[model samples]
Target chain A: MSEEQDIKKIMHVMRRAPHGSIYTYEGLEMILIMAAYEQDLSVAFIGDGIYALKKDQDTAGIGIKGFSKTFMALDGYDVEKLYVDRQSLEERGLTEDDLVVDVEVMDASEIGRLMNEQDVVIHH
Target chain B: MNIGILLKEGPYNHQAADTAFKFAEAAIAKGHKVDAIFLYNDGVINATRLGDPPQDDRNIAARWTELSLKHGVEVLACIAASKRRGINDEVMIEGGEITGLGTLTDIAIRNDRLLTFGD
Candidate 1:
């Protein structure tokens, strides 16, 4: 198949917080590798996943290698499409300004519609 | 329609595997083809034949094997994830394959939908 035809709209849905478990960190790892493929990639931060984009995270106290900075570095990897759930952020009392990275804050229905359009949706 | 399932949690410890299996079965019943079941993270443990759960409990590995045997499903465990969890080919159940992430990319591209079930 031609390279152009192989480009599928893949969305990685991050639903967990960082540090408490390895899901979010490893989920980011998967995104970084997939970024190299140059596909239509977008990451949705819902539920605890919004916490992953929180600013000033100090993992040194937790003794785990904090990879929250990796989210900031996604732009360099050409995986700039980051979407944060509006309700999730509001429920957590967080706003777009509180995040360390720039993201499109969208409603759940909008994200759900976008998800239905994707060829692949990887939930983490 | 061709569907691919990505199971990210281990059996019993989480409901992900059970949910994925039920979804796969439901998809097949609906006349959709289940292209493959790609196991990542602790989900790789679902492919091991060494599992010997209590008689009253559901044997997750055997369930996957049955799905593969009866429905022609391709059960695959990520090589990188499997290696770290000590799930080699020798311990893999029948119809389960140890493959790379590239294989998952192929499954994603070929399938009509790639549904992921995780904790």
Candidate 2:
């Protein structure tokens, strides 16, 4: 197959809160490995998943290693397509400014449309 | 179409494994090729042969083993995830293998669709 055909559109959908569970953390690890393959990749933050990008998160009290800072490093891996649901942010009274990484805050419908275009959509 | 399934939850405690098995079975019945079932997260628990639920309940691990044997579908558990959960080759069900994420990446690339079943 040609290089163009080799490139697949893969989206990692995050819909869970961080620290409460290991889904989001393991999902991030999967993204890091897949990023090296140079596929067209994107990550969507929905529901409580938006909290994963919240700035100034302190996991020290919970005794879990803080990985919120790792979101800032995604850009270096060329996995820059970070998306956040606007309604989810508003529901939690957060704004793009409150996020640890720069992301395109979009309506859920817009994200849904993008999700339909992906060959793979994994939720964590 | 060739399909790959990513199952991220364990059996009994959650319905992901059962649902994935049903989906894979239906897909195969329709003549679709199920390339593999890649187990990650708590999904590695699905590959253990040590699970012996009540006789009335479904044997999730054995179901996967049967699916692989009958349909040539590969059952792969992530090595890192399996190790963390104390799952090894000795305890793995028949037809299940411990593999790396690189295999998952390849499955995602080569398959026409990659479906994830999780929380």
Candidate 3:
């Protein structure tokens, strides 16, 4: 068996704008399932993806359910390894307290290192 | 490199596809195996065979084709999404396939990991 044959780490990049974006919820759900089935899976929020992690996602006037709740559901699936770009959060004035789910804070430089470390890197 | 790139953006746009290409190149450079590249939504246009960019600009459409041909990369355009964009296999020049959500389902089931790139 070769190195590639053995599954290691999986990274999900969620960069889509939050309001009225299906990718935000759908993308998070996708990786959450992968992590549930696989042990070494991880997730990263980058660019506009960080918007998905906003502490309170208001979807009422938009006529949809808030997706931040989905982030909390990750625990049920055992999607424990989570990450978010500190700069992205800061640029948007979103502190860790603003995230619906708890996650490790990472800078772009740290994210660069993490991507290289992963066996599979999925950027949504 | 079993890269599952879910491009939700178009070819002419300066978004998902271009950024995805960079990641694909980086994966190859780092000796990763991208077994599959899946395009959903507007991404199906990547294989349109009629995306005629300006002569001086790099042919993004052809670049994708070359990537698959030159390397052993598997480029799959989602059938459902393709129909939405009118990018069916009938419009392909050659060696392109129209797939479905099941294709992405299979990649998630079979590959070591699935990564998605969207706009």
Each candidate's DockQ score against the native complex?
0.50, 0.78, 0.22
Where is model 3 more than 4 Å wrong at Cα?
A1-5, A20-22, A36-39, B1-6, B11-35, B45-75, B78-119
In model 2, where do residues sit more than 4 Å from their true spots? Answer: none
Chain B of candidate 3 vs. true chain B, TM: 0.89
Candidate 3: tens digits of C-alpha lDDT, residues B29-84: 89887766777656778878876788898776776776687766778887756776
Isolated chain B TM-score per model? 0.97, 0.99, 0.89
- Could you give candidate 1's per-residue lDDT for residues B1-119 as a string of tens digits? 99998899999899999999999999999999999999999999998998889999888888899899999999999888888899998999998999987778788878888888887
Compose the digit string of candidate 1's lDDT tens values, residues A1-124: 5578789999999999887887888788778777777778999999999999999888888788887788999999999889999999999999999999999999999999999888788988
How far residue B68's Cα lies from its native spot in candidate 3, in Å, is: 8.6
Q: Name the regions of candidate 1 deviating beyond 4 angstroms.
A: A1-5
Q: What is the lDDT of candidate 2?
A: 0.94
Q: On DockQ, who's better, 2 or 3?
A: 2
Q: Write the per-residue lDDT of candidate 2 for residues A1-124, one digit (tens) a residue.
A: 3579778999998988988889999899889888888889999999999999999998889998989998899999999999999999999999999999999999999999999899888888
lDDT, residue A96, model 3: 86
What lDDT score goes with residue A23 in model 1? 86
Tens-place lDDT per residue, model 2, B1-119, is 99999999999999999999999999999999999999999999999999989999889999999999999999999998899899999999999999988889999999988988987
Instruction: Pick out the ten consecutive residues of candidate 2 chain B with the lowest summed lDDT.
Output: B110-119
Task: For candidate 3, report its TM-score.
Answer: 0.62
